[model samples]
Target: MTNLAKRIIEFVQRPGYMPMKPKTLAKKLGITKKKLAKFEAALEEAKLSGEIRFSEGGRIQPKAARGSHLGIVHRIKSGDAFIILREPKPVGLTDDIFVDRNDLKDAQNGDEVFVKLLQRRRSRGQRCGYVVEVVERATNVFVGTYLEEDESGWVQIDGKDYPDPIWVGDPGAKGVQEGDKVVIEMLRFPTVGQNGEGVLTKVLGSRGEPGVDTQMIIHEFGIPDEFPDDVLNEARLEAENFNENDLTDREDLSEMTVVTIDPKTARDFDDAISLKKIEKGHWLLGVHIADVSHFVQPGTQLDREAETRGTSVYLPTKVIPMLPEIISNGLASLQEGRTRFTMSAFIEFSAEGIPIETRFSRSAIKVTQRFAYEEVMPIIKAKPSEPIEGVSDEIRELLKNMHELAMLLRKRRFAKGSLELDMPEVRLSLDTDGKVTGAFEAEHDESHEIIEEFMLAANIAVAVRLNDEGIGFLRRAHADPAEAKLKAFSEFVTILGFELEKYQSKKHLQALLRSVRGTPQEQAVNYAMLRSLKQAEYSPMEVGHYALAEDQYCHFTSPIRRYPDLHIHRLVSSLVCDNVTYRGASAEDLIRLGHHCSTTERRAERAERELTKIKLLTYFEERVGEKITAVITGVERFGFFCRGVEIPAEGLVHISNIPASESYEFDRQAMALVGRRTGDMIRLGDKVIVEIASVDVDRRELNFKLLTHTASKPPAKKGAAKKSPSRGKKGSKKPNSKQSKPRKKKPSTRKKKSAQKRRKKR
Candidate 1:
């Protein structure tokens, strides 16, 4: 491979070099016939490693040194970005290469770029780079806010992730006004001091219009909001024709008291649970998942579509499904009192939640009831002695048993080092007009835990089964975090009251989380801990999940919304039913599929998060200048961000807003912005009163002003030595040097000691 690499480098350097295929390159290099294959493999590896590059003419050439690195640009904050390099670079240069505002070169979030990495200066701790080229745009289209200043027409992109108002000249702005959101096509990118120019492709409605904000996000993310004609036709046919033969060789569980527990507004109930106390000390807990694979067979249009979508995207008030509504909402959904095909996992547990055994099989089940989490929460919380009126004794007993078992499962899980950070969730209540009437916190109750515990158990059991047989399958893997991140997290927790010596171990991470469970700082610590752990991805390798503290875990529920679960169903079906064999996807194919699905899953999450921000921005637009109490979520050199105690969105508070009487300094070790003059610290988890200063819909952001005024220090006497605020060695905010205060003198320690001795003698 080294020889091949050297040969290719020499070949690309030749005069009049043109890109050519590996076959042609091999022939040009005069390799022997038997060694041609090895040469081609090396050529591919060189391309992947960025030692060689492909040009537009389908030809290969030597890569330009440091001029091109495969990377993705993340517009993480206002007017700033960080490019994550995908292709390997020289040793010691980390993948997280920074890009300043001017260096972005018209790149947006999620865009794949080729960066020109600048020289690293030891003066700056982090390496900052610039984008010389865009290898691929995340999307050519954008939802823009049209602006017409006295007929000088332009469109500003309204992507929530972007903070800058990207103005593009559209000769065809088509008379769109300030409030109208339009779709644009970039014709030319910006250079130096100008905005990019584009062509108006579409014209959405005015901002804050019913359904306009949601549609904007859907368009910005390029979500496939509607099914194609062929896909819809196929889905409708499958929904109309329910073949009796499909249920052949499947067990019928209609007699069981099966019920689905989901949110009140949930449209697709993809999972259901049934519980029965069959023995003196044991209970059979059944988890039934919607059998999507049964309807969307491989090699069909529906299967192809589902694979392409990977997973369904749920916005605040909308949904883009992986499967068509005819299947995901009608046929494949586990509707109450309707017989639907399913794959079931039955686990026998003692009075405790310890699983004695698990059984898997294909089944045709009719759900007896559909209860929302709100309805079930009251039942679960009811005492056995005081059964709720209008609730059946059978249902009450079932709820009680499930809650008990879920508690046991949760206890066992945390005992084994699971990371449980009970972070709050935001739920918005929309009126019939699709407007956000109210926003509130919808917290997790025991009912939610009951379902989560059961689903997790079934998923782990299935993962263990497939992996034990040595079958190649997609496993949810969470790799160990890097050492640098662990060290940083350790330093952070040490300042927040933890012993940092043993923080490197996962057990220490677990212990730290457990120690702060009931404290006021638990949520902030949990958010930090969550940031420290690695993200879970679907892979063909059994790498294990770190957050769950499980060696085996896979997505085995919610097949209606997720593709991996549907694929798992097909694989597990072969083991349970006769005449069924797992030929859905090969191990090699599964590898590719896993990567694609994981990418789509991330895309879906981003869309959902963006929607929440957009909704909050719109909702709070009317409430600007209203004062609210918030917790300090994060602190930096420039400012700190706050999340409202009862609100869902987070906003920033610039350090300049701290009263002029006191100069604020950001302390990296303490994760706080301290008032140097008064010794008042605005640290993580600290409460502060703030007023909504402004809201920018284009950025989907809120800027807050501190309402907690700082008290000024008393005046100093004449001709006394002055005192100044001290600063840290790293990443510290520069303090105000012009302001000073006189120091007060203290009595001598020896004189005070002699006075104390005299008092003692008396």
Candidate 2:
């Protein structure tokens, strides 16, 4: 019976309530008299089943609101859960609220459930709760394999743990077959004792299908794979119409030596550089960016769409563009030989890369050449090849000079503790059918850094100008890493036999970074340090970014894909033109905008990873049982995560799969897990070999078996402990009889240092 229906029948069968007035019943039940009459009628309908009998002059006692613990379910594991109470500090609440194997009652991770606050337990500061009511359910549109035929099959989803099989109803099932990757919509949320219903919303593709990974990526990131019709129509209309009046009062740089340098695969050219000699000591270095603000105005449909997207998401196989193709790839693109509108930054720098003066202007520019990174790097390195088509010798010399200045500027920036982190980017080469024929690392060469330096200079210049005027503007904020996290990281690196210099200023950080240069663990250390820091976000606050060591920083380079850049364009154009009468948003508005963009940006990141995981899973299906060298990327109670050094794909090495008798202990502060009995540790960045054991494309999970040199005796097996099957139909390997329980590791031997030393001296 439905929950609501059952509650109503129970109320009518209360002892001694058959002859009460409808008004009294309504008041007692917290409902109107008419609703109470309906409840009475429902009881009569149930008489056909002999499940209800009317009683006279009876009333049910009201249940009082009892004290309860309120918190979001942090996680569910081993028939128990950890809850994070909203009101507590440090967020370490002990809800060891045991939900026995048979009593989980359909609870899912991240659900909002209220548990009766039971008496205090032995663990200090930890509160246990008996789950009273489930206020909400965590529902996600899942991608899984379909499992049925005869046009009446159900889909066995990947994440849900089911006793009785849960499946999608027949009509809700699209034309998906067994093992097809399909998207399903939750039809019902799981209640206290029932599994929720769901239906198949879309049939993405079969397992190991090309391009399906990208589809999963966009979906997981909550990015729309296709533009809404209204947004598309508006974008198309904006492209078809243009006016000459749009260029009024703009500086015309059509005759200058303007050039664009980008990757060969890049489509939208949003930025370009121009060089011209104004005097013996002064040269005009113009950094021009496409004026996307002129086309996409605030409050317009196009503007809303771009703002919602925040930034374009780039995947290995495809690009989910922030703007429609009509603008991003066609009109707004600053392609060579095409006339485009730009907001240019003109900086006069000395021969030694010191800025003497700066000028900002809205201008019309025509690019004369477009050179790929590989083609331009040689020219900048003074080893010139054949001249770029339509480029003069003077312009080549200007390019060389620009390269020299950019390098110096980059050196200064990094010297200020900017963190010289350049992770390897995974690039996929796909065939015409979109199958990934090859995957490799894409390196950032000198050509990429040159353009980056110029863009950075331009962005900083714009932010400083706006801040000087006392106007509200979007500033990218990156605070110093938390003291706790930094301390933890320091302990970790020190344990690895590295000395991190302690300093009072950003210079100290830079010194430590220089010491790790060219080391094998350089990338690993960089990744760990980065994790200790918070993400950069947009804000109107004057607090500067500690990492960049900049007094001002803002987004102004890529307006086509990022909305904040468009705002920067409008603000700069108004200031440059002395049109200060224009009204702009306040600081509060910018803060709100930053919060929204930051949240959506995280969503976009998730989508990208989901797609990558699916492709990686498909890639592994072909390599089962093949051994590959990998690095320890993560460690948990369940297993150690090893990422292939060459492939960028990661898999798990479960504790049960470890052949050593040593127990594993996780160093929470050091972010590493170590083995106790055998002194066999699996720390982050340790190299090891693993063989692919299983792959679950539907769930996008990979499992690997560890290759150990010595087979340590296994722990005694408990009676009839069933092993959870590895995702495929094949039976999983049983634990060896010699395996033993891993011993808990002891605390580190290092002395705990005081935080007073970390603080700046007054």
Q: In lDDT terms, which candidate is top?
A: 1
lDDT of 2: 0.67
Model 2: lDDT of residue 676: 70
Tens digits of per-residue lDDT for model 2, 428-505: 666776665666778787788889999988998888889988889888888777777776665455544455545224
Alpha-carbon local distance difference test for all models:
0.76, 0.67
For model 1, the stretches where C-alpha displacement exceeds 4 angstroms are 1-68, 75-81, 87-90, 98-108, 115-122, 125-133, 149-152, 159-175, 244-246, 278-280, 350-352, 381-390, 498-501, 578-581, 709-762
Off by over 4 Å in 2: 1-140, 148-154, 158-167, 243-246, 276-283, 350-352, 384-391, 503-505, 577-582, 637-639, 659-682, 708-762
Residue pairs that clash (backbone atoms under 3 angstroms), model 1: 19-59, 19-60, 20-59
Lowest lDDT 10-residue stretch of candidate 1: 737-746
Q: Worst lDDT window (10 residues) for model 2?
A: 55-64
Instruction: Write model 1 residue lDDT over 509-622, tens digit each, in one string.
Output: 777776767655666778877787787888887788988889998998988998888888888987775426665556646766787788889989988888888788877889
**Distance from true location, Cα of 297 in model 1, Å:** 1.1
Could you tell me the TM-score of candidate 1? 0.82
